[model samples]
Target: MSDVETPETAEKEELLTEAEKKALIALRRDEAAALRRWWQRLTLTPHELEKLTKQRSLPRGVRAVLRRCDSAEAAMLTQGFRELWAMLPESTKQTDYRDEQLQVWSCIALVAAELRKEESGVSLAKRLGQQKEQTGKPLMSELRFQQLLSCRTPEEFIQRLRRALALADKKGVSVVLLASVIALWWREHRGRLSAKPTQRLGFVLANDYFAATSGYSHRKD
Candidate 1:
């Protein structure tokens, strides 16, 4: 093999790179769609959903760890974590993203415990913006939303996300959308430096929130 790349070799390499990028994109799309379907199935099956959400059905120890554990590692040790992981799509079970997946699972488990029911077909951020007080203000204030976006570490993100999920549950937001967004957020946050700036989770959320709130405000006016 030559030490230096020839022009023909370089062109072939670039084409291969493009093909790999397309394959990766397709894989991600399939994974996301699979996850959404999994959530939909869980929501449709009350008995199954109850096993994860109801305190009486879910073991006390597992529930406690999920609700209060300071780290994903601690949560992963519990039976609830394993059960939750088992319920996830196979495409999401890759060991390469083990830590990130565990954190996402932890958040999903916590939110599921609080979820009264699924409000499918709505984005989480839009649901938050749609929740209004008697005085016509968004239930999730801009400051709180900023706090969520500003979290610097996994611990901080988990803590703030717990509060946000609680609010979403109370406001009747879609748990399916909520979980999916949380997973997307973790993926984006972890690979943020390598990801295009325009494709950020924060940007997606901010746009959805503001657009919904703006529409709500106009309707109220």
Candidate 2:
């Protein structure tokens, strides 16, 4: 009788083990088709969501740099690159590889290809950096560019890129919001000067706001 299993004990034994349950959870996460929880966890408040969603609010360059792609996967990867772009230590608006714009692009292109276990990090970095000029402005569809970064083996690179992009996008949004606040302050205070009515952003302070938001220096010096 001690060795014989009863109905309750049998039912308990049928339940999934911890490892099996974890595997099932992982499988579901991968099968979701949209990598929602992974990316969407970066939340925003209702007010911020309202602001960021407005079509006219985001600057043209910022919009282009952070625009969502049609393919869910491609959108994630391209955004990964853009975010990575802002974090790299760079001299603002410089025209050389030392600026890191092209270098990160080159890295994106190389890691998108086969992992080639034969490759070493040093060799890979050289190849990636050397051919960045070719990676600039790919004429292919956005999905193709995402496909380039979807290297299956040794997945650490894209993980890092995705993190960098998140940082960049956050900073980009902060800049836009801060500029808008400054613009609002100027619009209210300019009233004391008895200035004539004009375009919303044509005043000197407005121009400075634009320049600051662009991450560009408007000064002649």
What's the CA RMSD for each of the models?
12.3, 24.5
List TM-score per model, in order: 0.66, 0.17
Off by over 4 Å in 2: 1-46, 49-90, 105-155, 160-221
Show the lowest summed lDDT stretch of 10 residues, model 2.
32-41
Per-residue alpha-carbon lDDT of model 1 for 1-221, expressed as tens digits? Answer: 11111123333233222322332221243333333333433333546644433312333354555556666666676665565566455667877877667777766666554454555455567767764655567758999988877777667777776676567664455544565566666666676442555446677578778887886677746
Candidate 1 colliding pairs: none
lDDT tens digits, residue span 93-117, model 2: 2545343324333243222211211
Among the numbered candidates, top TM-score falls to: 1
lDDT of model 2 at residue 98? 41
